[model samples]
Target chain A: MSERLNVSKTYKLYIGGAFPRSESGRSYTVNDAKGGFLANASRASRKDVRDAVVAARKAQPGWAARTPYNRGQILYRVAEMLQGRCGQFTDELRATGLSKSAATTEVEAAIDRWVWYAGWADKLAQVTGTANPVSGPFFNFSTPEPTGVVGIVAPDSPLLGLVSVLAPAIVTGNTTVLVASETAPLPAITLGEVLATSDLPGGVINILTGRRSELAPWLASHMDVNGLDLTGASGDLAVECEKAAAENLKRVLRPVEADQPTDWTAHPGITRMTTFLETKTVWHPVGV
Target chain B: MGDAVSVSTETLTGAAELRRFLHGLPGVDQVGAEERAARLATRSIKTSAKAYAIDLAISMVDLTTLEGADTPGKVRALCAKAAHPDPADASVPKVAAICVYSDLVAEAVRALEGTGVGVASVATAFPSGRAPLEAKLADTRRAVADGASEIDMVIDRGAFLSGDFQKVFEEIAAIKAECGEVHLKVILETGELVTYDNVRRASWLAMLAGADFIKTSTGKVSPAATLPVTLVMLEAVRDFRARTGRQVGVKPAGGIRTTKDAIKYLVLVNETAGPDWLSPEWFRLGASSVLNDLLMQRRKLTTGVYAGPDYFTLD
Candidate 1:
């Protein structure tokens, strides 16, 4: 028999729950490590980001309303799904520019990162909440609440960095509008597939693949988006998004260093998980 | 308090007359209306047009608070918001009106006393017209007496669906009588009507009975004020004007909660009803959340960036 034909996948942007082609109807060709043509990724437009924000805002209230234990279970499910699809992600990472060993390590680290944030989902409030020492006959307690919808810029390390950033935001019950890396988006999109199956509700994590410069500013200043993570953005791009985010006072996480790359395998702390959270304090009178 | 209604007597005499008049009106092609509304919805209104539309839509809003938990303070704040939607931006115009339940008309009037913004009240056993005719008229009379410049009255879906067309017609005419000079918006609650034919019939029925504006919903029912239904109402008004030479306005309330949704309705007016129905005098949106979106879009137009909801005042 003659050789069978390979049907390549049409990589589309993930917005809300569906994989829609960019509203702009544009795509960019992604090249493999040795400069071979991999596939065309959707060049997400500003409209796509706006739509993602709307979906994230819609899903946030319901997701945040869920019990913390359930949220943890959902996050763990995503990790389980990712671990099951480890070989596919490793191949995608290899195509993107990583060496074979590096690709496997990145995929494994990505799965571990999901598990890390999954545990934090149920522990975030207890570790961070505080009881205020008021002088009157009142009990004032302060605790963190999810800050509506978040916009995330997924970093260069497509698998690990993407998971590392997305896991923290959603673990705390905040829904996200994520812009995957411009050149390396396949792994992140594969993660989106894993998310779609892991009992995670649609719109909880809307992933878009495009040029960050074209898509980031809209999310940065989007009125409905409560927070923006620019951990993936560095140099002039980071500065531009930070400026735009000020228009709506979006809670932004700027890259710590101007040109430094975030080490995705490092042990991430409670910092990014709490970035998009608003601390609401409640006061109750002590009755006789 | 007396203004004559010039409805054609031949059509006003009986139920048979009203039914023939309503059914004789052109039937709405459900699929065609939905396709047209969807097409208009996709028309992109860009920067300059968006800014103009945001302000125009803001001016066309019937800023509403219809909850059971509503209070005087809430209505006052809503009225204040209607007068100045954005406290920081002075260039923005006030809203078209403050729509409240009849009980709070006085509070709305007191708050928006001299702002040139209108006060619209929902009466006639609103959200449902199950009350006795006299009680409903009393509700209308009380709202007008309390100083509502516009009255939004609900139709008894039971009466309409049960084919008692004259009862619905007479109820509207009676409320029109109590309205005095107040503009009357007849809510068809198209969600309950369920078909474009019924929505077309209800629009004609309301217009024939002297409704100054025909609204799509009471905002109390599900599937209220969909694009297709509103398009059918707009077509009815357009056709009515063509025949009677008297224009009526259209308001699509409920489920229209974004700047894009409001602009789509504007495009519906622009395309289906022409520019004559583009002003606050001719068109309205019965919504609350749409105002914030319009404000945010307006800010985006001015600053060349998108806006957050927290930057604007909440009512």
Candidate 2:
């Protein structure tokens, strides 16, 4: 019998729900934590960032228009799909240098975090919104609205950090263009597969794997992007992004405590979801 | 130009002669024309050439709004856009014209006065040329009197399809007469003509009957203005000029909604009809949404970042 060769998976960028190679046709070798070749992830260029923003901007209104309850159901469905793919995620995480137990634990926590955010999808508006008392004969009420397309810089904890940032953004109905962890992007690509199958709409979460420094500034400066999460960016890159983000007055969520490593395992409160939401206040005239 | 007029006077004598002349023209090889258009489309126009093409495409736009709901205010706004496509960027060139329904030509002319932007009105029961000849003639005359410097008249597709080439030819001639000094653009509504051969025939029929420009579609048809259809029309104009020493313009309206699509048409014009038609004077893009995109790309070229739709005004 002839020997069978191992069929390796190609790690391509996920834009608008389809896996496409970088428009610049550039790829960089990704090695496992032990310094062995793992895969060649697409080295996304600034053009990829532009394309991802376009897709995210296009999908945002429709996703935001989906009823809060429906969005909650869809998020829960993503958690369900992730639960079924736990083994694959664990294996990928283990390849990234985590122990077998650590990988399994991280995958479990990521799924739990997704569910935690999913529950908030329908309830966050109530908790954050307000009914104002005014002097006029008008019913004035304020509700939270998704802040259009958001650009997310995922932290180095590929699966858990990516899920922590992305789940909250979408649960609030905002679509996202995410730059995955540079060193460990294979897990992010795998998550894109889970997203594609999980009933989450296409373009709702476009994943780009590349140099964070190369891709982050374009996202921060893109006029159409309503919000930016600079979780993975640090040092000069973070400062440059923050400055560029001011060009469009984008709502920027700076990295915690100025690049202090975030403990992704900690209990994430509603701040992540609230950070990307804009409060819309509506007033109605009382009957004469 | 003199030779073309004489030829038209000779060939357009009757139905049989017009049919013989139109049918005698070369048949279009659909596969070849499509292949050539697709090949030209792949030409990567980048950097300085792209910047020039974008500006040239902008200048050639006939900023159009033909909805039944078009109001005078909307026509005024369109005229403003046609005059200054991007108020934020003074370097942007104004469009060639503002196209509207015949009734709103006055509004467009009022807003576009002194801007050097012509006001073009669609007339002759536009999109569907089913009206009587007198009504159609009246429509054209009304638009011309309303200060429309250009009249886009639709040919009676029903008459043309029924092999009454002479009737279609005479209708174009009559409308051209009503246009007087105003430039007359004959809309073939090529989508209804059914095939490439028919598109070729209609192109010749319109040009021979005294059309200043041969427009591809009314922007209301399903397959409005496609690359191959535009290609055949460009070839017709090129060959018509070669044979009669008269230059006719070509306008492809509808469904062209991107800087990329607009540039592809420019490339087609440059390659098929030669660079003589490259100017806004010889070729025009009849589109509304495509203008903003061209402006966006122009901004993208000038500034190194990709632009967003929110910055531009809605059409």
Candidate 3:
């Protein structure tokens, strides 16, 4: 029998739950860690960022309206889908210079991190909400609400870091437009496929794999985007993003430990979910 | 422009004559027309040209509120929006008209008395012209008496489909007679017409019956105002002018909610019907949400950043 030829996969941007090429019709070659050819990724333009923000905005209200328990189940389903594709993620991580064992560990940790964030979906209100004692004859209470669309720049830790930043924003019902790590974006695109089959609504999590520097400023300055996460940004880029984000008063999360790389395996606290949440306080007249 | 209307009553004397005149018109190549429209949509109007198109689109909007739950307060608010599209920016041009139901025309007229914005009422049992000829004429008469500058009448699709072209033509001519000085826009409700040939025939029929403008859809049907359908209508108006020397306007309402979609319609008009039909007098957009989108894009061009819906008033 003759040898069979391999059918290579094409990596495209995930916007509004469909995989479409960059509107600019631009693509760049992505090289593996060993300087060998890996694949071509869609080099998203400012228009793609704009489109992602629009999609995230359109999906925000409906996603936030879902019951917290329902949101939790959907997030948990994402972890299950990710687990089934563990081998592919491990292989992609290996191409990104991680050893076999290290790649396996990262994939497992990414799935586990997703599950942890899913657990927080239904219980976040209990921990963050409070009842206050007022001086007048009234009952006062404060509850957390999703802060609309969020723009995220995923760190280069590939699978684990991307999930660590993404799961928290969406588990709380806030839709996100994420710009994946430029050099290591294969894992993110693969993750988008997993999300597509996981029953998560379209436009809830738009993933664009492209140059972070070219795409970040557009997201920061977009007025419709309510919050921004600059985890992958450093130094001047981080400074630029903060300045542009100030134009719209976007709630921004600056990179933690800017001087050093983030340790993705460490415990990710509830701060990420809380950062993109707004507290709404209500006062009811007693015995009215 | 100097000649009187060439499509006289003699050309449309009876039902058989009207059918021969309409059926004798050229058949539309459905695939060719659709391909041309799709090709024109890819033209990129950027920078200064984009700014010009945005303002022009803003000026050509017929800000409409036709919901069954419409109130006087809602009509007044819509009228106010039509007059001052972007309250914060006076440089933004006012919309061409405010479209409402016939009963609310008086309220719209009172609110927009001196704002240079006209009041247009959808009449003739709008969205479905199933009512009698007397009732339809009464509907037109009431709107005109209420001070409406324009009357948008719906055609009897059932008559047009069943080879009763004279009935539809006579109804339009009668409503136009009632409109007198008011611009009479005839709605074909093309979504229910079912074919490109039907759209072309209906456009010619409306123009022959003294329609000041030929509008697509009532904004109440599925697939309202698509690019290909508008292309066919624009071509009909262009051809009608070539033959009769009378230029009519084209308005594509519904489903045009984005600046991109509106710009595509402008490009279609400019290309398919020449630049003469590019002005507000020659063209109008029958839409509500498209105005806000045009405003957001205008702000983005001047301010160098995107504008959000939170800043714009709710439609």
Instruction: Return the top candidate by TM-score.
Output: 2
Model 3: clashing residue pairs?
none
Count backbone overlaps in model 2. 0
Please write out the lDDT profile of model 3 over residues B36-91, one tens digit for every residue. Answer: 99999999999999999999999999999999999999999998899999999999
Q: List the residue pairs that clash in candidate 1.
A: A223-B307, A223-B308
After superposition, the stretches of candidate 2 with alpha carbons farther than 4 Å from their true spots are B1-9
**TM values, all candidates:** 0.91, 0.98, 0.96
Model 1 residue A109 lDDT?
A: 80
lDDT of 2 by residue, B1-315 (tens): 333334553546877877877776667899999999999999999999999999999999999999999999988888888888999999999999989999998888888889999999999998898899999989988899999999999999998999999889889999998998999999999999999999999999999899999999998998999999999999999988887789999999999999999999999999999999999889999999999999988998888777889999997
Q: Rate the local accuracy (lDDT) of all candidates.
A: 0.88, 0.92, 0.93
Give stretches of model 3 more than 4 Å off: A1-3, B1-11
Candidate 3 root-mean-square deviation in Å: 2.6
Q: iRMS of every model, one decimal?
A: 1.8, 0.9, 0.6
Ordered list by TM-score, greatest first: 2, 3, 1
Instruction: Evaluate every candidate with DockQ and list the scores.
Output: 0.64, 0.74, 0.79
Winning model by lDDT? 3
Residue A155 error, candidate 2, Å: 0.8
Query: Residues A151-269, candidate 2, lDDT per residue (tens digit)?
Result: 99989988999899999999999999999999999989999999999888899999999999999989988888889999899999999999988988888998567568889998888
lDDT of 2 at B227: 97
**Which candidate leads the pack in DockQ?**
3
